[model samples]
Target: MNHNYKGFFSIVLLAWVDADYKFMWIDVGGLGSQSDAQIYNQLELKECLEDGSIGLPPPSPLPNDDQDFPYFLLGDDAFGLRAYLMKPCSGRTLTREELIANYRISRARRVVENAFGILAHRWRVLLSTMQQMPLTVQVIIESCVCLHNFIRIRNPAIQNIQLDNEDGAHNHVPGLWRQDDNLQDVDMPKEGNRDTVAATRQRDYLKYYFNSPVGLVPWHDRMVGV
Candidate 1:
């Protein structure tokens, strides 16, 4: 089996969504071989984070009042752990606390997936592979995403598109994790492979928050099966 297959060229589509599942920013470029972290590093997100222009709400008063709670982006294992970008804990032998953290993060991350599904459903052009040049394809994808956001804003009813249950092959939840064409492994420095001390402390703070009265969800334990 030849693992170096590069038959079909592809472009990475990086998008950010709000809690309401609307596209806030979308970057369409980069080769399909690029990992999520690589593509993300090329974006202006770092600048935004530094400038404090993301409009994050003030932190709520949690049990741990010492640590500052900043807004963050939720990503999967393919991405690295950063102060602003959080990924689930790797490996299967996770503690109960880790399981809860993963579940909460996954639930929050589903917003991006839901946004993609809604875009594809509204704009049929994204349903199949584009035959046009990479640049042209990027334009088409961008246009579709922009239009999707436009329609979402003007027509609020379009937001509730029966995503919970469907028939046949589409029966799964609209936002469930699905393999993307651009998925690839990310090579991290051995020393930096682990989450940074600040990131880990922040994650631990959130874990405590999730189990506390302020952030506790009554059914979270049963749902996560921990």
Candidate 2:
């Protein structure tokens, strides 16, 4: 497993969250040696998605559009681009429309990012290495996730303040988590099969859709500065 700059062993936590910032699924205890893609490929969730047993919503066309698009997860460039997973276009010479689409995807991805932020903020133990057995550390992580979900569901108003908010002008207001030390992000290498022809086509369609009248948000062009 890979160690940190401090030469300490670490584990990667893979999480999937909903729009409400609740953990829908998670995989913990991935050795620091493995890349994000490697750990992701081993997930049963990936198999379920492939076998159509994950109960994902059926593909539907965007508003006022006829081409159907699947509900996909937003990921960063470290992940492989698939029909069920969308990532930003790589390279600097992107078209204006592509940049706008990327911005929209990023905006949506903040929910998942915020989820992790809240997790580390609430359970500060995750901010530091737990010098416990691997099995025990896994239990601690899982227990924190369960408690987070419980608090979020049983009493959402309390967590509302913990999350980032948006102002009337649509600018992001940093959450309480950002005020103090937070979790560190892993710098995973890009996967070998990062893109496929079908995936590229799907992403292209999304780019076009986001630029269309129905998909364009009022602030998108301004945000992208295009």
Candidate 3:
């Protein structure tokens, strides 16, 4: 069970889930030590976009009339920022605007986290580490995810059953940051190297949008301490 990347046995599961908690895609064979950004970059999402298989809406016209609103994947700071993928604003000293943007993005990204939580809660196999070989573990993980989606599809009302109490609280309050025990922080590249000029502009535009009246929630300022 030794992995070439980390010199120990480990397997990474990269997954994409929809709002309904249905798994859209799952990649279970990556090295455990690989970064989220690395795994995400290797996904076929970009290729699909190029082939027009994925049709994303243009950029928000309310925020930037001239810019196309590129639909993006929400990710934590462990992932790199891109025009098609967004990570939270990083820094110890963030402006009020930046804080709001981070909160909103984090809020949106919680669906993925909730999907994982529900999967682990319902499937005890995921609750404990698997001692099987990498390939076996990969199969188990993929099977569980697929089964999870199948169950949800057959019983859509199961989605209403809250598996995690914290999910309820956070869903109601948009800007609260919850610390996940399973996630380990990884240092991202410096801002200068993280994104292209267009990506930065796109993020800035979204930041403004979040702080504006259109995107602003009543408790946003208080939650973000803005």
Candidate 4:
């Protein structure tokens, strides 16, 4: 988050679990413009659920050093790991079964990308407004999320089929939203391609998080809901 560029935006990821599907982890992530600089401005969504910003649990061999606790751990990948950092496997290596389980878990994290797709095409925030002031940008981003979550939850009441395979895999069921052909402009990234390194890294980091032990429940069985 301390990084600087011509303009800056901090990424915020809202991930969850879905128990009924084959892949149960769903990650919904995005960038926060300026309104997110202070803690208060983020209070509404801060309490939304587990944000991975917290430091790791007390280390093994329990050190007396006060600074050992995690702090200032920025980035969306960090936040997404908060939920996966579950019990009993914090410092342990995963078994083969666990590895397969994690591979599936990693697949589920694509929900974040899908969510962004909806936001970009339907909401217009990511498509345009490329020049808003920092604070104003933040406000708009927050507003979109408020509206995003509202629509996401409320849609269930009327019976909808927008999200397919909430079981968490990178899947496309006929009843749900289809992959946008335009997405190919950015997705299906070419390996070793420098032009899209950032996107590639983001995908890798997401994979790394799912494959590692950073959640409270540990990547055990697919829960269908995060």
Candidate 5:
């Protein structure tokens, strides 16, 4: 396997998590040399999402609205945009609506971030170099995920203190996991593929929806400093 951008042999753990920070789907053992976009592009989950074979819910109207919207996954700029997947709008000069949309996506992505954070903080083994063979390391990682999900399901409060919280104004408060250096984020490539037409349209629609009367949250304008 190739060494990652960090110049060390590593494995990429691709995970899809829910709002509660539980893993919905995970693919482990990709060589770390690949960028996140590269690894994700090859995932079966991505294929399923694209082909609409993964049994996702159908498009539905947002609350108090007649306009229907497709269910989509929120990802960072590291991932490609798709009708089923939404990422932050990129660029330094963005509109107020675009900035609010980006802020919303960032807040949602924290579920994934804190999920990995709690996983690494509790299972400290992931934080260090494993001397074991690649196969063994894979099993160790899978086992940790299983146990992590089980604990979350059985006793949801097990890692409450480890999660990120929000203040009365909805400002983010970093979780305890952020204070630790156990798990570092995967390196993103400097460039991404051009957004597909459908993806661009969907993102634009969301930008409009998020700023509209129905989708607007009271704190959104304040959060984005609009």
Candidate 6:
């Protein structure tokens, strides 16, 4: 992604469970530091999302499932994500379905937002100007995200987020993942645990407490019928 220096630089790719919290997804254009890690090469992103290094849930769930879920990717105008989303997805379009799906996914993917919010509030760099050169900007931004995740784990918030044994599939809980307890300093695990096949999914859940805004263009086209 060639970030428009005169315009919006490549935003940091952020994915999180939303306030409502359902199925998770990430967005782009928050901070751009880690863009390289995200595979700036278009072919690479496609290949990665298709048959590559990582597996996303719902669209790429654990071994045993009969249904294949269509990925309802969302983002702001930046990220250029609409193109990624517009490609023929599943059985195809229906009125309000995309919005409905977006709502559900956004709910699940809000953790990153809160996490980012916390990071920005903590570091104050995110609140600073994006006018900086792309290279410098991306480094600072990514470093901060890595730091934020680290701190959250090292000093967990008082209430442990006891995930429901079920993946909140049917009962999508909103804004409940964050606990109200005060955070105390502790040594949180640096590397994520890989206990079961489900552990990969668990790591996904833990990744990106904050992120880029998923595009709204898909919804926009749906609404305007462009």
In model 2, where is the ten-residue run with the lowest total lDDT?
181-190
The candidate scoring highest on TM-score is: 5
The RMSD (Cα, Å) of candidate 5 is: 1.6
Q: For model 5, how does the per-residue alpha-carbon lDDT over 57-121 read when each residue is reduced to its tens digit?
A: 98999788898889999887777788999999999899998999898778888888899899989
Provide TM-scores for the models.
0.77, 0.91, 0.77, 0.40, 0.94, 0.40
The C-alpha local distance difference test score for the whole of candidate 6 amounts to 0.39
Q: In order, what is each prediction's RMSD in angstroms?
A: 6.0, 2.0, 4.8, 12.3, 1.6, 14.0
Candidates' lDDT values, in order? 0.67, 0.83, 0.68, 0.39, 0.85, 0.39
Name the best candidate (by lDDT).
Answer: 5
Off by over 4 Å in 5: 184-191
Which residue pairs show backbone clashes in model 2?
1-33, 2-32, 2-33
Stretches off by above 4 angstroms in model 2 are 2-6, 184-192
Candidate 1 local lDDT, residue 205: 77
- lDDT by residue (35-106, candidate 4, tens digit) is 222332245444433454433354332133222222211223222233323211112576544454444545
Give model 4's TM-score versus the native structure: 0.40
Give lDDT for model 5. Answer: 0.85
- lDDT digits (tens) for residues 1-226 of candidate 2: 5473346787778888999999999999988777677888889988997788999999998788887889888888778888888988888799999999898888888898788888888888988878898888989999999999998899888777877887876767987776764455533455655587888999999898899998887777777877
Q: Estimate the overall C-alpha local distance difference test score of candidate 4.
A: 0.39
Clashes of each: 0, 3, 3, 26, 0, 30
> What's model 6's TM-score?
0.40
By summed lDDT, the worst window of 10 consecutive residues in model 4 runs over 186-195
lDDT of 3 by residue, 1-226 (tens): 3353435546667777777778887777876666555666678875775465787776565443454577777766655567877778888999999999998887777787767766766676874658887778888998889888988899856654643333432345321112334322312222222666777888998898888777676677877765
Model 6 lDDT-worst window of ten: 185-194
Better of 2 and 6 by lDDT: 2
lDDT of 1 at 214: 69
